[model samples]
Target: MRFARVRLAGALAALAVLSAGMTQATAAPAGKPPPPGSEMRNVALDTKPVQSSTYEGGTADRAVDGNVDGNWAGNSVSHTAQEEQPYWQTDLGKSQTLTKVAAWNRTDCCAERLTDFWVLVSDSPITARTLAEAKAQKGVTATKVAGTAGRTAEVPLHRKARYVRVQLEGTGYLALAEVQAFNDEVIASPSPAARKWVKDNPFGMFLHYNMSTYQDEQWADPNASPALFDPTDVDADQWAAAIKDAGMTFGVLTAKHHDGFALWDTAHSDHDIAASPYKDGKGDVIREYVDAMHAKHLKVGLYFSIWDRHNGDSVELIQNQLRELLTKYGQIDYLWFDGWGWQVPYSQVPYQPVRDMIRKVSPRTVVANNDHLGTLRTSDVIVYEVPVQGMPPETNARPTDASDTLDTNRTWFNTTATGAPRSASDITDNLARARAGNSLFLLNVGPDRTGRIPQDSVDRLKEIGSAS
Candidate 1:
């Protein structure tokens, strides 16, 4: 179940709050509070995680390990035995202004075990050995989550506290895949380069064409056989033409998604196009896509999932894959990364080295990381996924981009019954919203199993083209 950080699985459920009297809101994958200070820092990484009791091998340290992967089977969860009231808390070494607390649930199974929970902040030390005594120490009742159905969840807590705790009131086993604490709110500002990026690419296309396309599901299992990735008439040219006709300046293709199915043949592993029947184990979708984009004088971008359920993860693999994509394919205009910080925190795949690698290979390429953490420290252009986080605020702190599926289907890929494209008005409306929010809109249109964008989607793009 350790999918290469398969965020496409939709594990996070966010609930946002502002101070005590502000109206509480329900959202998906909320961000840091909007205040100026140090960058959004995960204070938990510097502290030790403690819980009431450990269940089996579920140690409290697992929750602070920077992995938001909700699959307990992957050993990323912190577990506490069935008790009257169980709790997990971490110390900040000193009193700090806490912005928000995020707790991940066990998604592999028994997610209800973490049903009802509360995120409490206390200025006083939570030194009490019992839950009652601990609750007394909590200075502020940050928020109490009624029940969790395993969706994207987070809350903004502008409380100053030395200790933060996630506790359950009823008797039940407590399993947390991960727990994260961020301090200071996010203040927005666009990097000089990011501003230029936004200027050049205000609208683009997102092609979700991969193994998930063959499986007819939103997300394919990590162990899905590569043999299923058999596209009879895959045409990257058709994709480029569609985007060009749509009046889009750029396009990003899913070179590899969270399922770890790389589109290009690589030395990293065999879980890619090389393993499929396409081109007789020599197919290179990245090559075809890049060349096609260049043919139409359109910018080329590649969507790379940092988490991998198939080939596994490592900095070496990432660097090698980047080298191949950048060098072999010529200049990649932009690189859109997924599953970082949100799924597998940057702690695992440190940013500086990867950033240096990209700079070394392609200095002009821009980065759009979907970490869901709104800080320019990571993304060159902060990406707001429409389905996950409705819209980027008109006051977005940094250069921004927004993404949403054109298909009406729930998932990102084509399924048994192909999805109809969203209405042109709906598509254009979001585009306007994106621009108002200082973002470029990258609308996803997944290609069907035959390796072609559906006629309906192409027609929709034409309609959008006319509207533009």
Candidate 2:
């Protein structure tokens, strides 16, 4: 597991931004500090489930630390021999009032099985200690009534505990998904606020798996013949299940990479999975992906490259293709449109056309055209591709989150190839560094010649999960 240090240039720019905003206090809103002596220590204990937040219709792709080629359906699975702590912790720096504590899970309603939910609180920071130490801690757990999927548990003001932790125990079973915490007793947020939450999440998973695996390239040219596209095991459920296990908030799969190869059966495009060698050339990869992810109550992100390397489609033709993709897929949360070397001189013109098409198709969806062509181009979330090093300052034009750096606010995952190896210390430190910067680490475990994620990537991801 090899790793690269974050480039200094991006760090400096972030510092500059901090300096500009120095006058504003960066503390949490007014709240009473926890009582003295009863401080938060070893907070992430096994007695209570951690409150996690997850986006619906999302996907995850990876394997467990000790296991190989296995994908857990959801993240809430409990550990009997060893209990891994959740990724987050809270310190009662200052005791605040006691009104309401809301817990946010991956979804409001369960797709099938029911999971027991509770909030646990203790005056301690959950350290990376042994499970025995955590079990010894003094904490309180509250059982919560399950609500609809993607909704919050707005339980009334209960007794005030010095420390508060949200726990979700599977209904005597493994629960796959996320849980998040809310300070307010009541949960209320406008659309923009919700968008802020998504942006704040910063880190997410971008999965690039398809016939491209056989091609051994990112995406094939749209003009490339379908005869060249093929896959042996393309399991949508596995992809989503792996991602959820890795504790990723959401996933953006390459429904169609730059090659213009549509994973789903698209009537608008002759070049797609239906014309490929998988599932008798009759499967809708995107539909299967959407259904699989939605069943787990995860948020969905579709990646459609603007430049079709294979389709041989002209700029105008590609625009029409994108329109069809956007229109065909309903209830999408995020649309990832990359604008890198792919957008040369001629390819730039289709930007607005693509943006207009996305709005017409899914106006509610958040479109991130990081390179400056999409409608939300000026939007706060921009993806800066760190080719070899970290993100460059030039890439931080707007309030964009640096994609690979540790400093990005929301979810900036590491999408580097997985062939190489880095030291464990480097990987651990860099991920910690990223979390310190308020960015979530995204590990892109590229798949092999087959559709499965490479063993090396899966191994590295398990290392990360173990550390978390």
Candidate 3:
């Protein structure tokens, strides 16, 4: 697939006001690094179980039985035949600064059945007997919990609650093998270093050049001939130069898109740059991009789409590719996952395994799923596509980035034709709005098919750079 690169030059000067923006959004204290002598302890084990509804022999108490082997099946058995909203909750005995909740799925089969759900927290006791009654309870703070293919789903809850509940929204069996909870003193935020990076460098550049650039399509057909993919003069140095001139702190390249074309040479797949005519099938775009960014003192990021049209969806395949990207590259500062709802729903995608792999391979790399799931409570960062007017409200809770096209027409890939780029004044205003809302503004500009950013676009970027 193709991506565009945009520069936000005045971000450094905007930080002073941006800091104030973060304060205006919320009075809550910023997340602090974990103190010494901190450890996670399961607080929900053996807690009293409360349920809105349950299937045959699947009682609420079974959820907290401490036996992960026993599955607690909810009301629905089939997708078409299911409860309006099945739910299960537990009494934490007392109010606590709830940090995280881990839910285990039945491993025998049909893990995809439990797709979308929510984790609700309440300070007061929940006396609701039915699913509808439980959902109607007031003063209950809830966070959406996306389903996963892995056996367990761990979600962080940076809120206070005495009663924790899991509510299912989809039309399918709402089953859980186990439910565990922990307080902040025990469990801490996963990536504090990554969060600091976002706060320090609020603006970045996105490079979208790939096989699709040759085809002039957003997503190239997988069956298309690999020989057609070729750039006349691909220079990572030129891209890095533009980024540094624009005052961006980091750059993310599309290493692999929905079409499953790898920009880097990979031994795993034939549908990669290694199969293309570029560099006589010996070139490695990712290696060059990373080196170029490092040479410019800019952090490196890679974009990979989980939905692959060329290679059929497989968790093993995705993890293998991720292992290569995380291990082969020196260090990936950011990992962006796009094409969420195209091939498979976000819940069905195996995020737990991927997350584990990222943590193991590159502990510092920040992970962002383009699903816009939630603010800080959701993914590492909330990514908005073509947010010209500005980002939506609730995005202020966590670090956020809004990406838009530099060309007013909103094209992602460069065309032979030229167009007027967004004016400097307009671009800066967009940055201001993003900053005020506590978000980084990522501007996109498609490089030409010859692997060269259009001269007009570069000129406009230079104007933005100097003006900022």
TM-score of each: 0.64, 0.50, 0.60
Model 1 spans > 4 angstroms off: 1-189
The 10-residue segment of model 1 with minimum total lDDT is 10-19
After superposition, candidate 2 runs with Cα above 4 Å error: 1-200, 218-223, 312-319, 340-350, 372-380, 388-441
lDDT tens per residue, model 1, 17-48: 11122223222234533432224557775378
| lDDT, candidate 3, 1-468, per-residue tens | 223212111221222332221212212244873442233455786688766666665666656644443222322121222576767778899887777787766644667755677777789876765545666789777667665535456677777888988877755666776677877543323256645766777667777777777877777787787788788888888888888887778888888877889988777789999899999999888998899999998998888988888886677788889899999978898888876532345345545556767888889888876653222322577676643222423224346667777787766666544357889778777777677656677777777778877777777777778776
Using TM-score as the measure, what is the rank order of every candidate, best first? 1, 3, 2
What TM-score does structure 1 among the candidates reach? 0.64
Which stretches of candidate 3 lie above 4 Å from their native place?
Answer: 1-191, 375-378, 387-395, 416-418
RMSD of each: 9.6, 18.4, 13.5
lDDT (0-100) at residue 161 of candidate 3? 85
lDDT of 2 at 231: 60
lDDT of 3: 0.67
Evaluate all candidate structures by whole-model CA lDDT and list the values in order: 0.76, 0.45, 0.67
Give the lDDT of residue 222 in candidate 3: 78
Model 2, clash count? 75
